[model samples]
Target: MGVRFLHAADFHLGSQLAAGRGESTDHDETLESAVYTAVSRLFDLAISERVDFVIVAGDLYDTDSRSVRANAFLEEQFARLAEREIPAYVCYGNHDPVADAPTYVELPETVYEFDHEAPEEFCFPNADAPEARIWGQSYRDRHESRSMYRRFTPADDRIPNVGVLHTGLNPDGRRYVPVGRRDLAGKDDIHYWALGHVHDARVFDDEQPIAYPGVPQGRQITEPGPGGALLVELDAAGSCEMEFVPTSPVVWRSVAVDVGDESISSIPDIERHIERSVDDLAATTDRFDGTSVSVRDPEWEVDGYVCRWTLTGNGPVHETLGADPEAVYELTRRLRRTLAGRRPFVWTEAVRDETGPPIPAIDDLRGTDRVIDEFLALADEFDDAARDRFRDEVGMLWQPVDDHEEGRPDELALTDDRLDELVDRARERVLGELARRRAD
Candidate 1:
C-alpha cells in the first residue's frame, strides 16, 4: 500500500489578529481564538484521515520565548496524533529556532524534531526496513544562509524519499536557507519537498512535487483566505500526489467597492453595494482551482471575514469625501455600525476614498458657463503660496488626538504632489457644487 501523510508549516500559534480599524461587536473571543482553532482543525484532519505521519517544515511558534498557552496547545494536539499511532516530524524555523532549551510542555514520544547542527535523516516507523525517509534541519540562529539541500541525497532511493525544509526557496536569498528550484529538481530521488517561510500556500511543479502549506490562519489583512495544509500520497516508485485543505475558521479579505457611482447617492445606497459584495463573497466557490491545487474539504464555511474596503470611482460624493480625512473616517464608522451583527458577521476594517466630483468635461462646460471658465483661470494661477495657505487652513486636522477622541488621525504630509492632489480636490468640490445649483 502507498504511504499517506500531512505537510504543513508556519503555524505562528502565539500571534493574535490585529485590531483592524477597531474591534468587533461581540466577537473579541472569536478573533482571539482563530489561530488555535485553525491548528486544531489540522490535527483533527490528521487523525480523521488516518495519515501515517505529519511533517511541519518550520515556524511552529511566533517567538523563541514561547508562551505557555501555545506550548500547551501544541502538546495537546500532538497527544491526539499519538493516540492514533500517527507520528509527527518538525524542524524549527527563524520564529522558533533551536536554542538548546527544553520545551515547557512536553510533546508526546510520537513527535520527532530534526537537529539544527546539520541535515539529518529519520526513517519512518523503524530504520531497519522503512516505507519512507525524511530529512531536514532547524535554524540554529534567526538566520540560516547556508545551503542544506546539498546533503539531501538519500542513501537508498529505492523507497520514496521526502525532504521537509524551511526555506526562502531563492538560491540567492541570504536570510532563509536559499535552495534553488533547479537544485530541488536535480534531487530527483526525493519524491516530495515540503517547504516553508513564504506565508502563501503554493505548489511548484518540478521533476518532483514541492509545496508550501503556508500559515494555517492569517494574523493580518495582507494574508487573506483560509491559509492551510497539504495532504499527500506517495508510492514506492517515488510518485507523489498532493491536495490543499484549508484549516482556518476565520478568513481575511480585501473588498473593492465603487462608493460614489451615479446610482450611489445616499448612505443606504452605499450600504446596498457593500451588502451585495458580501453576498457575492459568501456565494463564491472555494478558490483553489485556478491555483492548480486540488481540495479535500472545499467547504467555504467560516466564523467570519474581516474586510479592508477600497472605495473607488468618481461621483458627486467627492463633494464630501477623500479631501477631508474626517468625512472618510465617519463613513467607515457608519458602515461598521450597520454591518456588525449578522451571522458569520462581516467586519469593515477600513474604507479608502478614491472618489471624485461628478461633472461633465471641462471643455464642454467652458463655452456654456462663464463662472466655471473664470474659476478655471484662477485655479491655474493658484500656485505654491496658495497651497501653503490651504495647508495652514487644514493643519488643525492633523493635530494630536484629543483626550475625547478614540484614535489619532494620520499626520498630514503636504509635499508638492500631495498639495497638487488637494488643490485638484478643492477644484472638484467647487465644480460639483456649481453643477448641483445649475440643476436646481
Candidate 2:
C-alpha cells in the first residue's frame, strides 16, 4: 500500500485579497474563510481517502504577527485535522518564519512542525517501516539566502525517502532566495521531492518529481487563476501518483475578450458575446454548474452556481458601448445575477478604451504646430534617465492630487485639471532652458 498525502503551501491567512474591499462584509468573510476552509476540506479528503499522512509545505500563516481572530481561526482548522486522527507535517516558509513559536490551540499530537536551521527527518507508521523519510528545514530568519538543500541527501535504500521543502526552481534568475533544480535532482534515494515558494504548479527534471502546489487561493492579480493543493499517493514500492484538486471558494480570472469588430445594436447580441466568454470559463471548470449573466438584482440563479464576467474589446464596440451608462448598468446587473451572492464576483472593471481608429499617422498640428514642436524639443532635451526621474518627482509632488481623484468629482477637478496649470509652468521652464542652451 502506498502513502497518500495532500501537499500544499502558501495559505496566507489574514492576507487581504481583492474581496477585502467588497461591499458585502459577510461575503468578504465567506470568501476569506474559503481559504481556511480548504484546510478542513483537504483534511476531510485525507480521512475519506485514508492517506497515511498530510504535509503542508510551508507559509501556514501569512505572517508571524497574526490577529487574535486569525489565530483562533488557525486553531480551529488544526482541531479539525486532529478530529480526523490524521497526522500533519509542516515547515515554515519565508512568510511564517518562526517555526519554533507556540500559539493558542493545543498542538495536535499528530502535527510535526519542522525546525529552522537543520533538516529534520521523520518516518511514518507502516509495517514495512517504508523508507519514507520526510526531510525538511524551516525559515529561521526572514531572508535566508543560503541554500538549505545543500544539507539534504537521499535516504537509505531500505527506505523510500521523501523530501519536502519550500524553495524555488525559479526558471528565471530573478527568483526570491534563489534555489536551483540541480540541488533536488542531484540527491539520491529521494523518489519524490515536495516543493513550495513559487505559487505556480510545476514539476522539475522529471528525474525527481518536485512540485509546488501553488497557493490555495489567489491573493493578487499576479496570483490569478484557480488555486488548490496536490494529492500525492506514494505506493510502498516507491512510485508516486499526483493529482491537483482545486479547493478555492472563488476563482480569480483575468480574461480579455476581443470586441474589435463586434456589432452591438441590441442587448441580446451583447449578452450573447459575453455568454460565450463566460461559457468558456464553465468548460474550463468542467463542472458546467455556475452562474450565468442576466440583468436583475441578485442576478440570474441557475442551480446556485455563480460565475463572474469582465468584457474587453476594441473597435465599434468601444464607440457603441463605452459611453452608454445603461449598458454598464445592464452589464453590471447581468454579472451580479451570474455571480449572485458569491459576493465579490466582479473585482475590477474591464478596461475598454478600445474605441476609435488607430492613432492617426503622425500629422502636423494645424494651429498649434510651432508650439507643440517647441514643447517636444524641450521635453527631449533631458536624457531618458533624467526624464524618468523628473517624471517620478512630478508624480510624487502631485501625489495628493492623484489620491483625491479616485472618486471625488470636486477633488478630481482640483487635482487633475488644476495640476495641469502647474505642468504648463514646468513646461515653460523646460523651454526656457532649451532656449538658453541653444543660444550658448
Candidate 3:
C-alpha cells in the first residue's frame, strides 16, 4: 500500500579527494578512501532502514576509465544490498563512465540500471499489482543533450508515478539534458522528480515534490558539510515524507573565526576558540535538519573534520596576526599538531589572514580630512556592486561553465563572503592609515 525508498545521487565512486596541497599526515588514509566510506555507509543505512529500493540518479563514476578498485567496491556494496533484497536504481551523468559502453564491474542481481538510450518505465512490486511506476533514462555519452523526460509516458493507472533525470535544468539544457523545473512541475502524472547533475541537494515543496539528493559524499571544500541520501516514503494516498541522512565520514567545514569579536590575541586564544567551535560542530552534526540539507541529517556521521579557516574581523590582534608573515602558517601548524590526533579528528587544510587593522568608524573618519572623505566616498561607490552579480561574472570569466572540469579544481581565492571581508578590511586599513597620517 505504501512504498519506502532512498533517493540518492552522484556517488562518483572512483572519485579521489584533493590531496598533496598541504602538509602530509595520518589522515591522508582517511582522505584517500572517504568517498568509498560514505557510499558503504549509504548501503548500510539502506539495510538498517529496510527501504524497499534506492534511487541513484547519476554520476555513479568519476571518469570514463575502468577502475578495478572502484568497480570491485561497488560490486561488493551492491551485493550487500542484494542480500537484503533491496534494489538500487542507477543512471549516469556527465562525469560518469557512460561516454562509451562501460565494461562495468560485475554488480549484484539486485542492481537495476536504467536504459542509457531512452526513457523507460518499470513498476515497483511488479506490473500486475503495482504500487509505484518509475521512469528514468541514463546518459549514453559523457555529453548528453537529449530532453529524455519528454519521452516519459507513464501508464494510465492510480499508482504513484516517479520520474528521474540527470539534468542541468533550464540554465544550459543545451548540453546536459535541458529539462526545466517549470516543465517538471507541469507534468501532472508524475508525483516525484528524482533529479541529479547538480551536486547540491535541492527540493521543491509543490503539489508534486521534486528533489535532488546531491552527492552522497563531498570530495572537497566546496562540497562541504553533511553529505548524504534521502529517505523517502509515499503512502497509498500519495502523501510523501522525506528525511535526509548524513553518510559522510569526513566533513569539509569552512570555519570563520572572528578574532576581533572574540579578542583572540594569541595562538592559544585562537586554539581555544577553535576547540569550542569543534565541540559545537560535533555535538550538533547528528542533529542537522533537512531544512539545512533540503537544498540543505546523521550517524551523527562525522568521523573527522577537514577545515579551511579564515581569520575575519578587525581588532587589536589583527596587527598581531599580521606581525609575522608566517603568523597564519604557525597558527595552522599548532592547530594540526593539537587537534588532528583527537577523537573525530580535526585537520587544517589551510589558514588565511583576512583579519584587518582595527580602525575607527567611517563616521568618525569623515569631517576630519578632505582627501580621506573623498577616498571613503569613492570606496562607497563600489559597495553597491551586488555580491551575487560579482560571483557570477567572476565565474563566467574565470571558471568554465561545464560539467566536470578536468582535474582537481584549484581553491577559489575569492568567494562572495570573502569578497565582502576583503572590502571591509581594505576600508579599515585606509581609515587606519589616514588617521595615522593626521596624528603626524
Best by lDDT: 1
Instruction: Single out the weakest 10-residue window by summed lDDT for candidate 2.
Output: 293-302
lDDT of each: 0.78, 0.58, 0.76
Ordered by lDDT, highest first, the candidates read: 1, 3, 2
The residue-by-residue lDDT of candidate 2 on 300-361, one tens digit each, is 11111123343433345554565676775665455544444332343332322323321211
Model 1 / residue 174 / CA error / Å: 1.4
Give the higher-TM-score candidate: 1 or 3.
3
Lowest lDDT 10-residue stretch of candidate 3: 287-296
Q: lDDT tens digits, residues 100-211, model 1?
A: 5448999898899999999999889879978888999888877877778888878867787888888876687676787787888898778889888877677777778878
Ranking by TM-score: 3, 1, 2
Clashing pairs in model 2?
A: 2-235, 131-159, 131-160, 290-305, 291-305, 291-306, 294-334, 299-337, 300-337
> Candidate 1: where is the Cα deviation over 4 Å?
21-24, 100-102, 283-292, 297-300, 359-440
Residue-level lDDT tens digits of model 3 in 1-440: 67889898888888786632376787888888889988988888899999988888988778767577887888998899898888887877777736465665778877878888678887886778888888998888777778888788987637778888888675454677877778888887888889887675667776678887777778877676778888888754658887877788887777787777546678788777777877755522332244433322254547788888887776777877778888777888898989899788888888877776666777888878898888888877775456556676667454422333322564443445567876776777777788778777
Total clashing pairs in model 3: 2
